[model samples]
Target: MTEGAVPLISARGISKSFAGVEVLRDVDLDLMRGEIHALLGENGAGKSTFAKILAGVHRPTRGSLALNGQPVEIADPRAAQKLGITLIHQEPISFPDLSVAENLVLGRAEDGWWSSVPWSEMTREARKYMDLLGVRIDVTKPMRGLSIADQQMVEIARALVSDSRLIIMDEPTAPLTPKEVETLFGIARRLRDEGRTIIFISHRLEEVRAICDRVTIFRDGNKISTETIDKVSDADIIRLMIGRPLKEYMHKLNTSIGEVALEVQGLTLPGVFNDISFSVRRGEIVGLGGLVGAGRTDVARAIFGVAPAESGTVKVHGKAV
Candidate 1:
C-alpha cells in the first residue's frame, strides 16, 4: 500500500460470539484498494467468521465497520451486494436445476414482478462477463453436472453482473486441479488490475505467496499480525498460525504396540480409490495424510458406509463389519 493511502474497508475492534462463546475479540484489519489480501488461519480460527461479517452473512457482536472512511451498516447478503461486496463461497452456491444464464442473474434480476425476462438480453450479458473471465461454457445447460471449476467461474460472473467492487473468495482453489488453479489466479490478477479489491482466504501457503500482496494471520479468534507477503517467510507464517514451531508439532511420540483394533483388506472404489489396505492397532495413533482430492475422504466414507466399497473387508475388534 502507498503511504497514507486510505483503506477501502476498515474493521475496528470487531468481535463476535455464538451462543455465549466468543469467537473473535477486538480484531482490527484494513483492506487496501485493488489488492489481494490473504486471510490465513487453521481450522476453528475466526478467519471465516470475520470474513462473514464483511460479507454481511454475520454481524459483529461489537465494534464498527467503515467503507471508504464512512461508517456503514451491512444488514444482510442483499445489503452487501448493494454495497458492491460479494462473497464466493468455498462450495459454489447456485440453483442446480436452473440454466447457467438464469443462475447468473437470478438474484439481481432487473425485471419487475409482472415483467417478462428477456432471455436473449440476459444470455448476451452473461456471455459478456464469462468472456471477460476467459471461460467458455454453454449458458443453456443446467448447472447440476458442471465441473467445480466451471461452477466457480459462474459465481465470478455473478459478481460481475452485480457490479461488485470487493469480492471475498473463501478457499476458491480447494477443489480445483493445478491447471484450473493457475487459470483462476490469472483471472484474480486481472480483476485486481481492473481496480477490484479481493479478500482471498486459503490454507495453501504456497498459493498465498504466489498470488497475494499482503496477508493477515489469525489465531484463537485474535488478530496476530498483518504483513506484506514478501517480508515474511512461510515458516514464520506457519509458526504464527499454529502458535508453535513446525518441528515441535512434528516431534515423534513413543508408545507401546498392541493388538490390532481395526483392519481393512482390498478396499477398492475403482477410479476413486483402489487396493487400499491398512490397520490400526490398539494404543497406537495413525494418520491418513494426503493432498486435496487424493481420496482420503473417500476412504473414510467407504469405511463409514456413507459410500460402500465394491470389494473390501473392514474388521473392527477382530470382527468384520
Candidate 2:
C-alpha cells in the first residue's frame, strides 16, 4: 500500500474463545488511515474481548488479521505494540505510588541500569505527551494523588509514547464529566489529524456521535455492521448492539407518589459520603452514580449498616425512630 493510502488495519474472520466459550466468531474489522471508529455493544456483547484480541491481550482461536493489508501475527501486547498497536484500557494501568514522569518514561529509561537517561529530557518527553492531549498535571505528583480524570490523562500519554498507530480505547469516557469527555475528544481529533487511527469502544451514544467517523456494532461476539457515522443514528447503533429494535432501550418515564422512605441526616461515613443528606420515600427511587470507586456502594451500605457508618443520623419519619 502507499503511504497512508490504505486502511491502517483490517481483520477477516477473526474468532476467539476463552476456556470453552466462544466470544468472537468470524468478526471483521477495518481501521482507516486517520479516523475514530466506535465499537458498540451491550454489557456482555464481547466488545472488550474483540478489542483485547486486537490489542494482543489475547490470541485469537482462528482467522486472520492484517496491518496495512499485510497479514501479521499478534500473540501478545508487546508484539502488538511492536507492530504499532496500543490499548488504553477502560481501567487505566498505573502505579499509584509512581510519579507521572516516572510512569511515562519507565519503558524507555529502563535499559538494564547501564544506560543513563537525562531526567530533564525524560520529563520533557512526558510533558509533550501530556501537552498533546491537553492534560495539565504535575510530573512529580504520584498517580494515586490525581483524580480519575487526571489519571486517565496520564494513560493517554502512555499510548502516545508507544508510537501507537492504532489506539484502542475501551470505555474511556465512562468516568469523565462532560467537560473532561470533551478534552478527550479534542485529543482524539488531534491524533486523527496527525494520521493516527483510533478504535473507540463506548456505551455512551453521545460520545460515539461526537468523536467517531465510522461506527461498528458487535453482538454476541460477531461484527454486525460497520458504517459511516453520518449514515447511522444512535438508535440504529443501539439496535444492532442488543439485537433489538427501539422498544427495548427507549422506555417512557413514569412516576408515582407515596410517603417518606429513606432519610439520612448529618450522614458521615469516613472517606466516603459525609455530611450527606438525601431522602427517598415510599414509591420513590434514588440514583447512585459516580466513578468506578467513588464510594457509591459504600454510602449505600453505610446507610443500611451492612457496612459500618463512621458517624451518621438516620430517621424513619419526621422523628429519629
Candidate 3:
C-alpha cells in the first residue's frame, strides 16, 4: 500500500466479550493516512463493535490501540475527538431543535464564551464543509426539519470542523438515493485527496468497489483478510463476509399473487404519514420499508391505530380496522 507504509492508527490484540460470550478475538485493524478502508461483515459480525472502540464508545475487554504508533487510552469519546478521530454514525446524528450552526459547534464551541458563536466564523466553517460535501441547505435552520440525507451531510461537516484525521462512516449511503450516493462518494474522494483517513463501513458491495481503496472483511468477529479493491470481486467479499458464496443477489421473484390480507387507503396522520395508500392480500406480507423517519412506522401506527389518526380509512378482512 503506497499510502499505508505507516498506518495512522493500528490496533492489535483486540478482544471483546458481552456477558461472557466472546464477540471479537484479538482482531487487528489498521488505517493509513489518505486511505478509505471498507469494513464488511454480516449481522452479529462485530463490525460495529470494533468501530465503536475506535470512536471511544466501547473499550475492548482486552486490546491495545496506538495512534500514530503511540499508545493512548481512549477513556471517552471526548478523548477520541482530542486525538483527531471521529465516527460518522450509520444513522443520522443531529440535535433536532438546534440550528445547523449550533449542532456543528455544540461540543467545542469557540474558546471564549464572550461571543463564543461568532456568526460569521461559524457560518464560514460550516459552509466550507457543506460546500465541500456539495450539499446546499440553510445553515441557520433547525435540524428537525432537514431530511436524513441532509442531516448526514451536516454530520460529516461536523467531523471536518473538528479537524478529524480518521472519519469512520458506518452505512453512509444506506438511506440515500442513487444520485445522493454519488454526491457522498464525491465527498469521500475529496476527503482522501485532502490526506484524511476514513474507515468506510457499508453493506453494499458495489459501493465498496466504487469508492474504497482497501477492503477488510470481518466474519464471526475476526479479521479475515485485507486487500486492495482491484484484487477482489463482489463474490469474493460476500464469501468472506457470509462464510458462504452468495449465489446471486437477484434470485428472488414472484409469478403468483395471493389473496388480500390487508387493505389501507386514506390513512392519515397530520404531522406524520398523511393519507398513505396501500394494499396487501391474504397470506401476504407487505414490507413497509424506507429510510428512518420516512414514515414507515408512522404508516403502520396509523393503520394499527396505535395512535389516533387525524383522518383516514383502513380495511382489514373486508372490514375497517
Which candidate model has the greater lDDT, 1 or 3? 1
Q: Which ten residues in a row have the lowest lDDT in candidate 2?
A: 106-115
lDDT of 2 at 206: 78
lDDT (Cα) of model 2:
0.82
Tell me the tens digit of each residue's lDDT in model 1 across 156-225: 9899988888999999998888998999999999999888899999999999999999999999999999
| Candidate 1 segments whose C-alpha is farther than 4 A from its true place | 110-115, 256-260, 266-299, 306-311
Decide which is better by lDDT, 2 or 3: 3
> What would the TM-scores of all predictions be?
0.89, 0.85, 0.88
Cα lDDT, model 2, residue 196 = 90
Q: lDDT by residue for model 2 over 1-321, one digit each (tens)?
A: 134466788888888888999988998777788889988888767788888888899999998999988999999988887788888876788889988988887644324321466778777877888777777888888888888778878877877776778999989888888888888889889988898998999988877888898888888888889888999887788788877887875896776767877688777877777787888788776898887787788888877779867676777766663
Question: Cα lDDT of all candidates, in order?
Answer: 0.90, 0.82, 0.83
Number of clashes recorded per candidate: 0, 1, 6
The best-first sequence of candidates by lDDT reads: 1, 3, 2
Better of 1 and 2 by lDDT: 1
